[model samples]
Target chain A: MQRPQELRNLFRLPLPRSFQLGSFPLRSHLRWILIRIVIKTFCGLTNTSIQSLERNKVASRFEVFALRLPPRIQPFDLYEAILKTNFRFKQNDIVIVSSKFVSISEGAVVQIDKIRVSHKAKVTAKKFQMDEKLTELVLREADQVYGGIPGFLLCKKNGMLCPNAGIDKSNIPRGYAVLYPHLPFESADKLRLNFINNNRLKLFVVISDSRLMPGRLGTTGIAIAVSGFKPVIDHRGEQDLFGNILRVTMRAVADGLASVGVALMGEGRESTPVVVVRGFEVNEEDRKMNWQDLAIDPLEDIYIRSFKSK
Target chain B: MQRPQELRNLFRLPLPRSFQLGSFPLRSHLRWILIRIVIKTFCGLTNTSIQSLERNKVASRFEVFALRLPPRIQPFDLYEAILKTNFRFKQNDIVIVSSKFVSISEGAVVQIDKIRVSHKAKVTAKKFQMDEKLTELVLREADQVYGGIPGFLLCKKNGMLCPNAGIDKSNIPRGYAVLYPHLPFESADKLRLNFINNNRLKLFVVISDSRLMPGRLGTTGIAIAVSGFKPVIDHRGEQDLFGNILRVTMRAVADGLASVGVALMGEGRESTPVVVVRGFEVNEEDRKMNWQDLAIDPLEDIYIRSFKSK
Candidate 1:
């Protein structure tokens, strides 16, 4: 072809909703483009008044909830949050759970003053090529310091790749750090199951963190863990009219969904820690999906093998 | 914290225009949006018409072109087509070799009567679980019948994933089938290097094939391979302000770009085999891109990879 035809718009598919995209260095309209996002916020004094909404109750489609749990809320609060949010809170057309909140709820956080790193952690740290000072910090009882190339420091306690080694500086003073939510999968399961039993909505719960992609402008969340959404689209034993059988390709629709969700969730603002998105079309058969369905193995990660986040 | 704060206007840098998605499933606007794209198509074509458009001649923004080559096309006709299509003709804008014509120019077509089969291919055919009758017919000098799962039957040769292994009944009509264009990557490279050296415009050349995605509707063109575009984004040593250092993660920007380009290219129908997308940016370090970049190592694949995309 000397000059090729511009082949855009060859088919029909609806474009996403428009929103202010702040994450990319490039202009992105991927955020706020979906009309079904549900958000919860704590603004006025009414924040204290917002109680955990109960289960199976009807709530607004577009809700902004404020939750006040006991200090160091328990996993039960995770359920309560959903109940209240979805009851009078109503299920989000789409729901988002903050990684920090999930970690804290599951007691994923560690009080630096209270922690005592283990001997094993220290040795593992060294073997992984971690810094001595950081290793010393971990030896004092870190869950796991991220293990990777020399320059990059993933979380020491959790496998998470966030700043502070999966430490949380949020919901706490600057001096203290938080850890990833413990038993995130369990936490995810409970909420997902409860949503199914109660609200009758297909909920996609993701254990998301502010992941750092090197060279990219901002933290677009990776679905570190997820459930409910059908994660993969499998096309095996099928042929084109032309008859070529497709081999080994499944769309990572969940990650793209999570990426879009995180994009919509915005990078740590909107005080809507958890967002509920609605109006997406999916069937009952797709509910309560597995985390593995959505997870891209670290090895298969094209970007992962090639680059490391420091 | 119950709800994270909603972050507004997070970009310190301006968003690039590439991410400005007007809509998803862009099928509706195909008829009209095409007009805006035609302008781009003309620009790319006019620049490369008749002969290689020289580098730096009209190389500021990314432009699109439609080139109908020589042999099948007359130089005079191309020159006239260029002027009528657009006023510019530079070598810088070409993104890939046109495959349809490549097959024609290479003359890889073969008569059905004269053929030979590889024992390896025959064994492989049985491995595909083809029917005995067809298998017997195919065994007549055919290397193998390449398709089977359910209802698909394909020719034993030709590298295409078509009903007849991309073997054609139309192009030949009487009794011949076209093989895949030979040394296709070589043709792609010549066009690529020519753009790089002659027009000097930053470009990538992809020799594409229409492929089917499992579980999704319709086919999209995929790059057999590519050069010039930064195929992958390696995010090593990167940290979000959250401070999580990433050990592995790279964005397959080129492949995704190709997928989107296919969406824009619209398979064989547009005959706009080469798509010149502007404003799509990537880290420039790895300019010599690879097809390997797109292949998720089998181990990392999660499906089939009972564990991952293994």
Candidate 2:
């Protein structure tokens, strides 16, 4: 399919009304060329250091396509549907699936009304000023609740620091909450194998979720599980532009990719459950890596250290 | 200017040796189609809930083009050079410029040898085992030095928590360090005005820098300054998918875009100093927003509360 033209048209939409170029008397196309020429001439006269613009093409280009799947679909079925898309998968293509999708597929949804609230959960709910049923669910899912403000519970679940153990109450049936997928690494591996066996393509799969950064206003992307790629790219011994060896520059490549994916996949009614990230380079040797490769030691975490005094 | 064809060829490169399809008997194209058919058929038989894949068009798409500029170019000159490119800007189009380029343009580079080191700098160098000259520079730039590890000084700079006050020693001339641009919001405004006057186009400009996130292994992008767009999109009081009013879901849209830009403009040898982000929606009223709009009150920050006991 001629997808590039469609992609190009996507970016060629008209500018907003406030930025219209109608102020120029000449036609838009001719005026744009004239403006470009005048700007180049002016720059040439003003800045002697200004040289010819290099046509050095972008070394890596990433195109994110959010694939919408039916609600409550199974994981294997969702994989098959994605494979059936017109967009073909190539080697090293990273398919980032939202953890919510995986959890729904894995039957991780909990009926809040079905839960038996404990005395501790009720007391904690009263103290936190939260719903009793929600507190019971949070208590069951959380490995440790560090406490929170009136409306939330800051906790650790599955070795991850999150609010309410990543129990999301959005986009599910009424009175039901979605849980983070259990054994996400296993789920990623299963999806990877499905892709390989069916399409004969080697692809990286990342199960992603959004989490709030400390002191940041909104949530950024985080990788819960990964398969067929190195989660971190260490640049400790790599030389910088000044020829200085970088000491603490290990890049969380997967997490960054997940952030890009999540940004494209809006948290609200976007319905974009799957995002295809192409053109990223991944190490072949690290194909067997899993979630542990992306996790940080809680004891060594700087934020955890700050909380130590408390 | 047939860029789309060029882009298509870029992704069509041969797969890696480990993932090559030469082992398969059938041709690559035919085998892929066959595999797709087989998967669809198998899925249909096994999963009754499997439905047709919906071709729900992507609501928003972003393409990042890394434009290469000469080293040590001035800010206005850099903006003029960007205007000289074939790609045209429109309303709400985001132009992300690296902070290093802005610093160099603003004459924020300081020669380390020119600094007169103080007794406190010497003591700090001895205690932290860093160069006295660099320590002096950090001391000058840092508003409050919280503490440090062996090599890094954790400090608050310009109302942001950063390391060494975002003083970078890489990608500059020898014996010099690049300081974060003075009044980044002002610089962003200047660039925005340049775009408006030259191309007669409205553009959102983001001055970006890389910073380490706590508990994360690598750096993510942060927006130091922005012009021509709202930095945050408040989703508070909006109904979620489950029809529950969202209490705290304000998104830091500019910061996420910066992260996307930095990921493309890699920290290492990739000389992409500017990235053009096209196809994002921005609020018209937010065009006049400054840095303060994106900042949170330190007293109200949850992380600050955790650190208070220390």
Candidate 3:
């Protein structure tokens, strides 16, 4: 399939190699206007919905729809499953798929009996009163292990703090555990490109996982992987209502979107594995986002940092 | 104004003093059926929409709409502002108002100039590089002071963990800082009753505040207080998709709904302070919920507990 980004490259307008520092915004603004006009003309020529294109510019409101799918025992085509739902994919729409769903689609499931019982895993499992096989899987999947409670380990996986490294034994069949989607960022990027190249529709994709927050009961949503947008909207140097410049008010857009999706996609037999969010527009960047965009270093985290001093 | 809960009490049927343990669900189910029939007949007798009442029984989907209001300079009638939105409040609809809005409406604001600083507050201010007056306010408001960073104190206020004891110097006039609602749970309960008594509509009210999670950027929504429903839906003893009994899978419904509201109510200059959510229904309870319903002891928290041993 031809890359959809080729269309943007075809419309590239070169600027002067050097410009005044203060003129950066004006230059970018001029470039944005030119791209908008070109894209508008292209949409008109191609009979695409101009309203959808315009809405992406200043859309504030959002409508989230849950797409329920049957439970799968084996890997299946996620793209075809989405199409089977008959939900029309629109430009700039956000598609949030559960990490468990993604794992199932990618055949990331493993039988508990198949895991090797490493000595460290066995010791850790004994201490935490967890299954040794699950402990091994968690250790293998985690980037860094912090600590554990009974039957669960709190760890940083893919720069996100989650218990059990986002592994799932609850939703799948007995004795089979599901690991997080192998290379989640790449998987999301590939899925995003499939939509873009096949239908000429650029949309965002988030691999979401439910997480328990500190000092709070129940789980909220966190984005394990994201594609087609900057995960965080940095609001540095922007004035608050009191006119003081905000230095640390970055909006974790991806995680927020994930939470919205998780609210609809329950962790039970409701069977909703996919959620389609429309009218939630963000700056669709071509550059692929990685873990750094949404997560802070554990040392820099207030909760983690405070624990050290104590 | 009459308390809205009296209507529920009027229809309370006496239950058998003792029952089989397995028959509890059945008894509740029968009671629920009876209540539904009575409410439906009552709606038929009155001019209420029976469809709205029926929809509450099985509402799995939700549509959140943001209601923008002008910035207030002083305390005003929150009920009237909601009425001014011209939004219809239906039975079981969830209303989420920002804590800042509630604080303003209740005049939970203080001028920074008029605060008396104690020795502890002065030491804290100097240590954290915070204003002495603001530190004094946070110290007073906090239930437990954990620690601090450069400019913010991490404290537990009303069973919620937050920085600066949930004090706000933003989104209001300069030289004034807004505190958390003096009695958040009571405020939410009172507002819910206003809707029920005035409009004859029983709706859920959530006092929401944006919270920054550890190791993540941007703030998601948390319900500081909720009325008309249990904040957490305990899935204990319920089977997961794999038929395994869930032990620690309670759904934080109020917080999830609040996050949906905060997504629409942007923290910037959007001016959206009220969000009306429809089609998301939970069991309506007459019991008033305190902070204990949603939060655990800090010592019991996994994140905090892990730190103690280290």
In order, candidate lDDTs are 0.41, 0.69, 0.76
TM-score to true structure, per model: 0.39, 0.77, 0.80
Tens digit per residue, CA lDDT, model 3, B1-310 = 1222333454455544443233445455554444444443333321112322322221234556677678885999888888876554567888999999999999988999999999999998898888899999999999988888878888888887878889988778788989988899999999999998899998999999888777887778888899999888777887877787766788888888888777777766777888877777576778988988877766678777655534
lDDT over C-alpha atoms for residue B305 of model 1: 21
Ranking by TM-score: 3, 2, 1
How big is the positional error of residue A25 in model 3, measured in Å on the Cα after superposition? 62
TM-score of chain B of 3: 0.79
Q: Among all windows of ten consecutive residues in candidate 1 chain B, which has the lowest summed lDDT? A: B2-11
Per-model interface RMSD values are 18.1, 7.9, 8.3
TM-score of chain B of each: 0.53, 0.78, 0.79
Error of 1 at B147 (Å): 28
Per-residue lDDT of model 2, residues A261-281, tens digit only = 877777666677888776667
Which structure among the candidates has the greatest lDDT? Answer: 3
